[model samples]
Target: MVVSVKRDLYGNGRLVKASDLSLGPRQCMPSSQSTATSVIFQQGLQDCGNTLQMTSDWLIYSTNLTYSPTPSRNSPIIRTNSAVILIRCYYLRHGNVSSNAIKPTWIPFSSTISVEERLSFSLKLMNDDWSAPQTSTVFTLGDIFHIEASVDTTNHVPMKIFVDSCVATLSPDATSSPRYEIITQNGCLLDGKQEDSSSAFRSPRPTPDRLQFTVDAFRFVGSDNSMIYITCNLRAVAENQVPDPMNKACSFSKSTNLWTAMEGTSGICSCCDSMTCATAGQSRRFGSLYPGHSRIGKREADPVKHWLLLQEHKVTTLGPLLVISTEQSQARTVTPLSSLVQLWVVVAFVSLSLVILTIFGIVGKRPFKLHCRKAGLK
Candidate 1:
């Protein structure tokens, strides 16, 4: 006996089936069908056409029959399942090329992966013919290149480009006095592990008269984690004029010895004051001439006569005469003794005369006597 069963597509379990067990001795014989009829019957059971024409509801069968209702080859699911989608990328390219032919080039996925995964990237695309960057380029995730700019502190109109550090040169508009110096807070010129003690920047020296100095700063990007700080000290020397009281000019005549003795004839002597005398000269021969002594002979003999009298007399008055007549000069002058000596001599002479007259009066005799000879009387 033969048996047949019916089951669901998944076939997790079997289902019962029914079939006839008894049969008559003779049954009508079946007729053989042509190949076209068989082919037509098969075609009617299973439909075949382009996937583009298929609708979502249409049942599909896989070649292996492992899956049913397979997605269409033209759908997004097929593109995702297979590696058919192409992604475009971009990046910077460096090389000499004609300006007109310049165009953006695509970057490979492998190269962009470093920037995308690490979340950090840098482009030194600007003209950098100078030194290296002061700080490290390493950055934590989410960090961004904030800004890039330049200022013409030097005030050069054409604008020269400097690399690595921000060049904070002395501006031409800056004040001429009180010279300015440039300083930096971040890294300085580096030579191996050592940093240069000198400033990384440049500015003019301090002015001559100004006591204080003006300082300027220029900062560059430093280590990714650190902030910049700058400070400077200014060394300056100022010029000043000190008054020389000793060399100050005196208002009195410098030529007269008596005047010099009396602190110059003006009677306004600096000797007693804070100032000191610097120069002196002798008075003219006729400086002390009497009304009738203006004669040329007297004038010519004045110096000799004055000298002889000063030597012979030893009197205070003669000292003034001698000092006034002679042409004696000095680079620096002090008070002369002639005036004091003369005053003492005058007092001595007056006292001596009074004593003589007193003596004569006490004796009751004349101070002077006149005698006449016998022959002159006859």
Candidate 2:
């Protein structure tokens, strides 16, 4: 069904324009690799932007990118009116080509920034077992938030990753002036600094390329909104290299009154307290990766590769994470006022029934006596 949408579908000399076309909230982009004579494409629109008019409960998915319907690659292609959308997004309920054959599942969502297939980073809220991605973002207080940040290195060199910094904010804008810093100063868990905090890096690291951690579930008490977004900076380095202050994972131990390293020497954790962790012998190959770009939405693909640069970084935000408070987690339908109103209604109904019965009994007795007197034999 999507054969026409393939990168090589169009014939030679067919008109096509340069595009940075992307899909989904994570902004999955099409490959734009090219040479003077030819181009290579790695990904394509999943459904050729085909419109899926769904019923019987489905989520409407739509995207607005200009599209032109043309004949298949086998035939001479002629362009029609370019549709305003590049790819119309929609939840696939049931389809022959869908990946979810055993069970009805929505299409897979990918949110990663690829720097020329060298590295791509993604942040996800995981389930307790950390086996699969959690579908529901809603979380209750006192629950441990299992978070993971990973990189897809493809067939590239072996690499190690660090959760240099992380923060939780009430809004999606991670850099928004007001933010809560959960981890900072390279790979230090700030919450671990507190004796009562359960926040720390997962021990016996899950994998060399992944950084897993936990945060105590919480909410912004003063804010009315229940949503919270977690943003983190992930840095990658060579696997064989020794961990440094800039590339280490460190958590403070309250019982021992000392800092412990998850993979390396705790000395690297010393700088965490002063927020002075620094990366040594590094240059600005791709310049600085700030908290703004390459975020969850504005991900960019840089095909250009650097020769000596062994380090790359990305910032990702996973969010709208609903943190349910104690009061909010209880059933929402039952409230004090509603309960009181129901009680009053029942009382009023019973009172009206008693009055009706009493009136009927008085009239009935009088009728019975008058009938007896008429009979005169009573």
Best-matching candidate per TM-score: 2
In model 2, residue pairs whose N, Cα or C atoms come closer than 3 Å (at least 3 residues apart or on different chains), thus clashing, are 61-89, 61-90, 62-89, 65-85, 65-86, 67-83
Which tens-of-lDDT digit does each residue in 1-378 have in candidate 1?
A: 111112122254422111111111111111222121111111111222101111112222211011112345566442111111111112233322336464446656533432233111121211122233213322232222211112211111121111121122111112332222231111111111112222111111122211111111122233222212111221111122111211111222223421121112333233322222222111222345534555536445564355223211100000000011112222113236666788899999999999999987867643222223433541
Model 2 Cα lDDT, one tens digit per residue, 1-378: 111232322455554443433333344434456433343334333433322222223323333333335565598865543322233334644423335445524433121222234566767778999998676766777788888887766634667888878888865568875688999887889987765578888997888988888888887868543567788888888777687676788888888877898987787777776766763312222235433434323324331233234578887766657676767655464587689899999999999999999999999999999999999958
Q: State which candidate has the highest lDDT.
A: 2
Q: Counting only residues 3 or more apart in sequence or on different chains, how many pairs clash (N, Cα, C under 3 Å) in candidate 2? A: 6
- Please report, in order, the local distance difference test score of every candidate based on alpha carbons: 0.23, 0.64
lDDT for position 169 in model 2: 84
The Cα RMSD in angstroms, rounded to one decimal, for candidate 1 relative to the true structure is: 57.4
RMSD (Å) of each candidate, 1 decimal: 57.4, 17.8
Segments of candidate 1 deviating more than 4 angstroms: 1-91, 96-197, 201-378
Q: Once model 1 is optimally superposed onto the true structure by TM-score, how far is the C-alpha of residue 365 displaced, in angstroms? A: 99
